[model samples]
Target: MAFPRVSILPLLLLLLITPFSSSLSLSDTITKDSLYQLCSQPTIRKHFCIIWLTNDPTTFTLNFYGLLGLVIQKTQLYGYKNLAMMKSLVRTTTDPMLKIPYGSCVTYYESAIKSMEEAIKFAILKKYELTSEAAGKAFSSINSCEADLAGRNTVPSDVPLRNIRFKRMCNIVRVFSDVLTAKNY
Candidate 1:
């Protein structure tokens, strides 16, 4: 007895489509719940992590290392912005006192940018410990800039706010890198 032609076509189509559909679903496995779980790590700021990741449409399709790379890029951009702002201030300020802090901030931001570059390299290599360490160094650079500016009588209002946001980015990178490291071990 032979199977009908119509029945054989349906079976063949199902077999062909099943693998493609399942692979697509697997790529989309980073749901809200999973994001919540990732952000819930003790050192991570859950709200910031959730908001940042959710805002980026690409986050849903990326794995953990890819997410880390995204965060690193954002942090690097922040560092560059801060560096440029400080450089501008240093050059334009007439007051020698203001220039001192602004110059210090320029150095700090440069260091932060360097550290973030290192983080990106280590992240690409899947060296989670070095990635976390580089992020920590970047965080420390931001904190140092903040503290240096705090002591000055005159400072830009936006500097403090930028410092806060930049620190948050660094925290996310550090925590994510740490989580990845722990999972590997």
Candidate 2:
């Protein structure tokens, strides 16, 4: 059987566009997977990163600024939860040293939540540099709180492990911000 004659112009256009379109789609998929992998890097909590980063479809579409907003939101949520637990400890603990450090931890987590709020606003405004700096400070504050608890020999068994999740989330956002900023994306 013979095929009917086709216009070469349309065929040429299709040939030209097909590879470009396919490659673009493929790259997007690769980028999404890379994000999941980057989020689950050795320094971070792999399972936690994988679960959170992959839970929503929008997470894959976010630019660095948008990603920063998500990170800030998560940080605030975690900080608040941890703060409440610390407050409970402060209220219940009989040991003076434990009470003081737990109280201090509550204060630090509050500051972190405030800083993360700032980071979220900056990210929303597309001010990634400000967002990065704010997030970095927030991350540092949590680290400082953990350090204070350790120094006082009042560190909760869960605080260090919990901080690892915070570190990973903040660090991933920082990495994305750095790449986008440096590339002027």
Each model's lDDT comes to 0.82, 0.67
In model 1, residue pairs whose N, Cα or C atoms come closer than 3 Å (at least 3 residues apart or on different chains), thus clashing, are none
Best by TM-score, which number? 1
Show model 1 residue runs off by greater than 4 Å.
1-29
| Residue-level error in angstroms, candidate 2, position 146 | 1.0
lDDT of 2 by residue, 1-185 (tens): 99998779987687556532132221243356556545543445667777877776777777544555676787778778887887888898877878777778788888877887887777677666777787787788888777767765546678777766676677655555454454444
Task: List the candidate 2 regions with Cα displacement exceeding 4 Å.
Answer: 1-32, 40-48, 55-65, 151-155
TM-score (C-alpha, index-matched) for candidate 1: 0.80
Clashing pairs in 2: none
Deviation from native of the Cα of residue 45 in model 1, angstroms = 2.3
Quote each prediction's TM-score.
0.80, 0.70
RMSD of each: 9.2, 7.7
